[model samples]
Target: MGSSWLPEDAEGKTLALVLGCGAAVLLLLVVVVVVWTRRRRRKPFDISLEDINNDPISVKSAPTSRTPSPKLPKRLSCPDAFQFPKQSLLVRSMTVDRVPDFTLPPERVQPRANGEKGANTTPLQYQQSLIGSLQPDLYSHSSSFSEEEDNYLPMSTYGRLWYSIVYDAAVEQLNVTLIKVKDLPGRGSHRFPRDPYVKIFLLPDDRTCRTSKVRKRTLSPIFNENFVFQVSEDDIKNRVLRFSVYDVDKRKVRHSLGHVIVPLRDVDLGHVDTYWSDLEPMTQALSSLGEIQMSLCYNPQTEKIKIGVMKARNLKHADFDQDTRFYLRVQLFYGRKIHRTKRTGSRGASVEMDMNESLSFSVAGKQMDSCRLEAALMMTAQRNGGMLTHDVEYGRVVMGPFMYARGEELIHWQEMQAQPRVPITRWHALTSNVSHD
Candidate 1:
């Protein structure tokens, strides 16, 4: 009887134990499912490198779907740039808009500082003298610019005097330059005749217009009336600054066509000496050849010096041909002496010299010892490239102090002594332009 009861109790206990274990397992599985759902919601989808690198396992390779999208360049832009139409573009002309207060009032015009006799030359008297001095031929021949009819008005101070005319030309867009006037004879002497040159430009107004597809623009004259220019410096002791309008196309130096004298006081003579050093070089040349023969370069206005090529052997026949090429250079010093040397070819031969602009054909000709050669270095405005070239029977050559057409008169050399002896190599320069009509 006890055995039967123990079996029944044991079975019941076993059944209960099995039911509890199954319930515990079900609760653990529910907790794990909830945790897994929460984790999946929080994390983003991630592709593993291993799966991406693996080849698709298929019994057959799949056909490309539709047309495969074209492979694009890594760089988004095309190699060639997108071009815009130039014809459609229009640049508006820039006008001065307004003229600032630039002129001096009549009351501000001060009496000449050099006293009445020096600076007080009446405007009417000055104009009379100026008109008297002009070459009528030049004024009549020059038709490009209008003739001056206004009475001359003396510009105020030296700063105003220098800047007024300069600014006026600049306003009208003309190429006018101011170089220091040099070699002014003291009081009443006229040995050094060098006068400072100011170049006037009557350029076509066509330059201001741009190319347009519809139509071409017409140009207008820069000024309607002739300008009366004058200067008054209270600093200059004896000589007064003066200016005149002359036509270069007509090729005339009418010193008085229209002139005004301004008395300048406290004039710095030190400024005049700045350009004096340029006179010392005469002519400088750079050559790759060992020898050269120099010919005097003369001013077209006054060809004071003439150069001829002569053979070292026959000092008589200075005539040269293509076959008789020699490096010949002659520098004329101060329009007096000719320094001709055998700049090229075989050395050890004595070259003969003759004066009077005549060639003496003799082997033992006497040397003109009295003649002295000096450099007449004058800084002038450049035309075209501002490079001067002379054509000779021998060959073409380059000149120094690379000058270009600009209003700048800045010195070529910092000091006379600082001038370079020989060019070590070629050099490039920046260009500047001026327009004062």
Candidate 2:
């Protein structure tokens, strides 16, 4: 038997295999063409030497032919070069271009008769002209301000009190009737309304004074209260009546709103005529508070200063409470600051207190000249069911070589300085202007 090169049935199989190989070869050729075309069209990243030289932030290097040697951007080494520019940028950003409303426009120079502009005016000359033009208006405004100032009265004159004084010769009594008060300045919206009352004092005899009933929550208070003063017909001419308006607080502290003084001699008291008077400012005087006695002794060898609170007399009873206790506070001041502070034991409140307490402070001899001594009388009273105690300053006295010490206080300091070892005792009238810590 003779065999052929391939089986006769393998013809179809060989033809199918050749067709599949041709399709695969065609697909591979198409992919290679597409890839080669894209590679030719795409651009290569190129950075030129001119661009690199123009950019200050770029790193400087020798020219390279092959694909600009990859270099990172360099940081600015000299930061100071940009400092002023940054500040200028900030200043420019903050600067406002708008002109203020108060500024005036620039004035143009007047033309000359020769058909030429006049010499340009200097800034100074233009300013002077502007000032001259504004002089009359400024003068008028200043005059109006002065008028307002003249009309402006202090807070003490914020209200007016109406009252009538009558002298009854038969009874030898001066009767004063307080009609009402008007136009009292309001304290504030947040604070409580003022509890206003009137106090009548016979001048030179303030020991005994009469007070009216308090009217609450009213700026204009109606106090139709009558107060009588026992005086002789001959003595009435020399007497002066003082009406003091006060506001009382919950703590029983009296704040003087205003006061008025009327001389009986000036008023025809025979007739019952009502008069209105504007209240005046209350004067703060040392003699009004009371008096205190203190002794000062300085030892140069030991560099110590001693203060002896001998006694206090004529202590003003501000609260008039029987259970009030009084104490003395001694403060040593150096260079306008309190260097040492000491207080005596509490004593029963009285017109005359016998303390006999001595307080000592260590101070250099050279510092004695600049040092000052302050003695304040304080009073404490039990309030709020005796659970809360309130301390109020009765009065104070200051002694030093400084300007704060005047009259007897200065003399006492000089005496103490002159006699170092010997104790210098002096009486000083207390003042109400006590410095509150």
Candidate 3:
């Protein structure tokens, strides 16, 4: 109020002063920022390639394939190089003579794995023990052999039946041939004739005769249905045949016929056969003739398996259209046991279990001469009722067959000495590089 100036002029002058101060501050800030940025960009660095190289920090390179070095001796870490002898040291000293004198031939006395013959109580026992049990009526069929025969046959006076012989030469394999008898017995009204229409079955044992009989039908006296069987191979010098015959007409069955021994020459494996080792025995039982081949092999150097085969032929008569099952029945030991002793002797000799353990071979989906098959092994054991259920897991382990692979198609007892191979170590990097900043 002392210097009464116009309110508008005073206000305008104050606004101008404030605006000018702000503009000056902004200009100073812009200049300082520009100077600082320039100094930073132009500054000299003390770092050098040699200084960085002193540290020698190398960048790792990608891996590349390389021919692996030969495996070192046992002194080095090489599991594959470690080999097991053909025969175990612990059991090597033991000889056949040391075996019990009362033992029976392995073939004649089936292994416990094959349950009691003709007595089928095992399946019933298994069913009862299994979690999902089968109904008793499922297998319940109480038809006696006598009753079965009576129902199937209608008793009638004997008729003059016409018998025609047709040899399916293409389908039949002739191990032995019995030509039709030149002279026929005079027709007579005699029941069950003395010769009983004797038919000379050129039998080479159950396998040969059974294979032959299955393909043909004959009741002729010239054919010996009761012809004793024989197998004569030099290596396999003798084979005793024992089997039963069923008198279906008489409704009678007899087992354990006297043994028939036959001699044979040793077959040269190299020239004759093909062996499938990796395959399961059960597979052999089901395969077709064209597809299946009798295989053989031997491996002396165990680290890398080796094998040879002999005698491979097509099946003459196939039971099933396709073969899916197979079996290997090796007659490794032959002997008999005397009464009173559970043991047996050479005459009552059985298979040498150790020798069987040494045998190895392989099988594949397709025909293959030599192939490496992968293997995995595990053993299952049980606690005989003598042990407690809670301690069963820790009970004494009864080792079973060594498994090579797992799952539904698992194979057992695959020969480790002669088996597939695998790489033990990984590839290594070769190039070394460095990065600079």
Candidate 4:
């Protein structure tokens, strides 16, 4: 019984001894750890310049703006805050200056990695070098051109107007027929386009007397129009018939293209009553505003002239006071005037009147061979007192001392002075754009 008991007891005692040894070892380790922790807590770790220099593994420290430590404590590898010394001659001798993929402008320095420049130069030293390399080519090139020459001079000469003149001796009227204006400039030059029209006036009167219908978007325009001017055959030489060409663009801007001035004296009335004139620059002429048919009758007994202004047709329409109601004003070459004769809402207007007033009757008291009968079509707003102002210029027309629609010599003065007859009627051409002084 004793032997059997002893085997179990021995095993138990052996297990107890192993457990006691492990407990003793654990207690000893805790005591050693507590003691070491207390000693480390009492003295803080520190680093110093002397320790750094003395160490075989020299570490580059950051700026000394931080407080310097007393002495360096042993570290696991090296503190990240310090720059470690090169371990081998390979790192010390080798240098790298990497090239960039893109080129920089000459004035600007190429920036690099590690914030280092062409050399191992300090950052401030590299910045100073950049100022010395800066150049001034940009400002130098910009200062060489003129501001005004870049404008205005590029636009130059264009082609001209050709026109002719005629005189009707039976009725004694000076007539200008704009046969056609040809050979004007062309459009291939990438130039500002010309919306060309011709305007004419008989001067010492700069007043614009008439304008041809504007021919749009062409460099060359053709207009066949007839214009008449009342002049004594002797007084014709003193007159200059002026023609002006213009570029009209109602959406953008308008400007004069050129002008041609032809003197009546320059034209030979005997064999050559009609000829072409060259168009030039800077000056121009006048027109009657529209077309009308009229009859003239002179009673030799009363010494009075009756002008039957039958009606106007193909009239240029105008809007004054933003509406199209119009009345008429008639005048003679000697400044004799007839006012407020008729009013009409249609573009075709009718104005008939007889003159009982004073008449200088050209070639005084003689048969009126040719006289300018001017009809100024006017407008008056209902809101205004119908008073005509100098600013109002709508349309104008001029008729002759001729038969209404007969196209024959019809000045009543000539018929009455020669042989009294019944009144004859004829259609008269009218021109427009009469400017008021």
Candidate 4 Cα errors over 4 Å, as ranges: 1-157, 186-189, 250-252, 270-274, 283-437
- Better-scoring candidate (lDDT), 1 or 4: 4
For model 4, give the RMSD to the true fold: 29.7
Model 1 bad stretches (over 4 Å)? 3-20, 23-25, 32-198, 201-398, 401-437
Ranked by TM-score, top first: 2, 4, 1, 3
User: What 10-residue stretch in candidate 1 is worst by lDDT?
Assistant: 273-282
Per-residue CA lDDT of candidate 2, range 1-437, in tens? Answer: 48767877798799889999999999999999999888777723355878777876565465545466668898876655667765453232455689557966876664334643324667576567667876775432111122244246444446888788889999999988887887776676654468899888775465478999999988789998889999888778766687888887778766667777787779988777767777765432224456888898989898888889988876543555677898999888877788889999998877788999999989887776788888889988898778998888777888888455755687788888889999999787665533221
Q: What is the C-alpha lDDT profile of model 3 across 60-155, one tens digit per residue? A: 133335564679765645443446554532332445756566966653322234554433445555445453445554533222223234335443
Strongest candidate by lDDT: 2
Residue 241, candidate 2: alpha-carbon lDDT = 81
Ranking by lDDT: 2, 4, 1, 3
RMSD of 3: 39.4
The residue-by-residue lDDT of candidate 1 on 265-284, one tens digit each, is 32332222111111111112
Error of 4 at 417 (Å): 59
For model 2, the superposed segments whose C-alpha errors exceed 4 Å read: 1-286, 434-437
Q: Alpha carbon lDDT of residue 231, candidate 1?
A: 18
Provide TM-scores for the models: 0.18, 0.36, 0.15, 0.29
